[model samples]
Target: MVSLKSLFDLSGKKALVTGGSRGLGLQIAEALGEQGAELVLSSRKASDLEKAQAHLAGRGISAKWIAADNSRDDDISRLVDDALGKLGRIDILVNNAGATWGAPTEDHPIDAWDKVMTLNIRSLFLLSQQIGKRSMIPNRYGRIINLASIAGLLGSTSTTQTIAYNTSKGAVVNFTRALAGSWGRYGITVNALAPGMFPSKMTKGTIEQVGMEKLTAGVPLQRIGDEDDLKGAAVLFASEAGKHITGQILCVDGGLTAVLSSS
Candidate 1:
């Protein structure tokens, strides 16, 4: 019988988290690092990475940082290379870097749509391909945690006009499912976290525009996610505890989706 602590222990595991400099990415990074995973945090800004590294250090978690823009093919390649160099090989890959544009479906800019799709979906493929080929597949063990949004699950509401964001995340839902099916034979587990409305750089504009009270009004919990909300789920997926769980999309949205399903 596997002990609970042993199952959840991530000691000596090496992880790479894209967009780890802030917001949801940073929160997940902190969770993984605290569980004894050695980490490489990546983002577009070197300065932000520095601050994140310091923040992790203050928490007694050591982490390495590589600055790369996840949206660009070249930068994505370099990020994988640098991360492998730092950590020897990645046991876990967290594809958290993403972008969104708030525009109506008909008036959305093509370039903006491309940007969202490229970072949210394309980058996940590129990084997973390289990392799987170079590391996880060869090792026959890996855990992939994708950052999906509740926007992916629901249709457009009157308060929001982010067509591209919703569409790209919806693609992520299928992508997570498809990849898990393809990669499970290789001993790799792939899953996604679908967060409802968390206060972050990405959602700040939407929250401000929609108003916090209105956003929380319909949620069964009457609040948005807080800092520590995603930690347990993240650690579970990254550790042996979740070895048997794959292709699942766990929503951490304060029962917003539950309300949606019932109403």
Candidate 2:
């Protein structure tokens, strides 16, 4: 019988988290690191990566950061190569680097739409391809965690218009399922986390625009996702405990999606 502690332990595992300089990416990095997984964090801004590295160091979590723009193909290729060179092999890949644009559908800019889709979805595919072919497939074991959103499961609100972000995230949902189906042959488990209203730089505008009271009211839990809300879910999908689970999207939304589903 496998003890729960042993099942959840990730000691000796190596992880690479994209967009890990801040927000949910950083949170997930904390989770993996606390579980004893060696970590490599990547993002566009060196400054932010420095701060994140310092924070992790304060917690005694060993981590290294590679600054690269996931929106650019060249950068993503280099990021994967750099991570591979440093870590020897990547046991976990967190596809968390993303961007968003908010505008009425009719008035949305084409450039903005492209930017969001390319970074949110395209980079995810490119990085996964490199990591899977070079590392996971060869090793026959891996965990891939994609960061999706509750917005992917539902349409945009009247007040907040993000057609590009929504469409891209919706793609992430199906992408998770599709990839899982194809990759399970190699002992790789592909999963996604569709988070709800979390207070972050990305959701700050929407939260302010929609009002906290209304947002919480719609959630059955009557509260918003907090700093540590996503930690457990992230660790579950990244560790041995979730070995049997694949192609699943676990929402960390404090019951917001559930409320919407019923109503």
Candidate 3:
């Protein structure tokens, strides 16, 4: 019989999470740490990374933090090198770092589009390539979870106004499929998680401006995603439970994607 603990155990695994200083990334890092994986968290801000590292340490989870902007090629290389130096091996990678800008497609600034595409799509692919080629492919074992969004799978009304973000996330979903197909033979599983209406620093301002009722009312579940919602998905993808799952986008959207509401 397979024990529950054995199914979720990551006792000796080393995991790296980019943009892990706060919000969904931090939550995922905490979840993986609790599951017994040595964690290395990275973000652009040093102070935020230190604070997050302390929070994880207080939970008795050993964690290290690195400050690096994912948009820079050199920084991306340094991040992978630094993580490998500290953890010896990267058994799992959570590509949770991303950014978004709100602007109408017609009026969107060129810089905003460039920034979002570079960080959200290009950087994610580059970092995944570095980890897959340099370590996981050689070792023949690794789990990669890319953080996608509901925006990728469905269209938002005009009020949201983030075409670039939506486009980049769509790329993420397809990228996961392509990578998984190519790497599965090497014992690597690549997947994506599309979260819906999570209240984080990224969405706090929007929620405050638009009001929670307006947001929750649209979701079929009538509630926003919580930290608990992330734990199971993260653990499953990173543990034995998801060994056979690959090239799929798991939507943790509280039934938001299932319903077509004219509200």
Candidate 4:
């Protein structure tokens, strides 16, 4: 019988986390690394990647960093190639690089919308395609975790307007399910994490704009997500413990989505 601890262990597994320089992406990286997965972290900024690498090293979690603009096709190709060259194989992938532009739907800029979609959803597909075809499919095993959002599951609020971000993440949710069905025959499990208010660079502005009290007021748990809130869920989806799980979107929202569902 497989021990529970052993089921969650990711020893010897190699993982690639996009947008790993900070925010929720880094949290997930910490999760996988702590579970003994070898890590390759990627983002657009060399400085941020360097900082993240040092941060991980401080915790004794070995990590390699790559700086690349995943919004472009060439960069996506290069990222996959370089990651594979360095790690030899990618057993888990975390699609976490995303951006948001806040504006009323009528005033939302077309260029900004394109930017969010390209990075959030397009890059995810390209990287997953390259890695799945080049490694997981050939090896017959893989775990792909896409970063979605509670916003995707619900519409925008009066306090916030992120049309592009919400649409793209909704796409990510379905993308996770569709990809899982398509790839499960090859032993690849695809899942998504739909997170709520996590304090990070990307969310700092929203929290500030919406006010922390207002943000947490409606949440059943009455608080924003802490640094470690997502760790366990991320590891579960990335390790053997979740081998039988696929096409599921686990929300780390402190019961926010549940409240919305019942209301």
Each prediction's Cα RMSD? Answer: 0.8, 0.8, 1.5, 0.7
* Model 3, span 179-255: residue lDDT tens: 99999999999999999989898898789988988888868788999877888899999999899999999888888
Off by over 4 Å in 1: none
The per-residue C-alpha lDDT of model 3 at residue 38 equals 93
In candidate 4, the residue pairs with backbone N, CA or C atoms under 3 Å apart (3 or more residues apart, or in different chains) clash, namely none
Taking all chains together, each candidate's TM-score versus the true structure is 0.98, 0.98, 0.97, 0.99
Q: Which of the predicted structures, 2 or 3, would earn the higher TM-score when compared with the native? A: 2
Q: In terms of TM-score, which candidate is stronger, 1 or 3?
A: 1
Number of clashing residue pairs in every model? 0, 0, 0, 0
lDDT for each residue of candidate 1 in 1-263, tens digit (9 for 90 to 100): 98999998899999999999999999999999999999999999999999999999999999999999988999988988899999999999999999988877888899999999999999999999999999999999999999999999988755688888888999999999999999999999999999999999988887888799999998889999989999999999999999999999999999999888988
Q: Under the 3 Å rule for N, CA and C atoms, how many clashes does model 2 have? A: 0
Candidate 1 residue 22 Cα shift, in angstroms, is 0.7
For model 3, give the RMSD to the true fold.
1.5
Question: What is candidate 4's lDDT per residue for 92-153, written digit by digit as tens?
Answer: 99999999988999889999999999998999999999999999999999999999999889
Task: Return the clash pairs for model 3, or none.
Answer: none
Q: How close is candidate 3 to the true structure, as a TM-score?
A: 0.97
**Candidate 3 local accuracy as lDDT?**
0.92
Residues 131-216, candidate 2, lDDT per residue (tens digit)? Answer: 99999999999999999998899897656688899899999999999999999999999999999888889988878887999988
lDDT of 1: 0.93
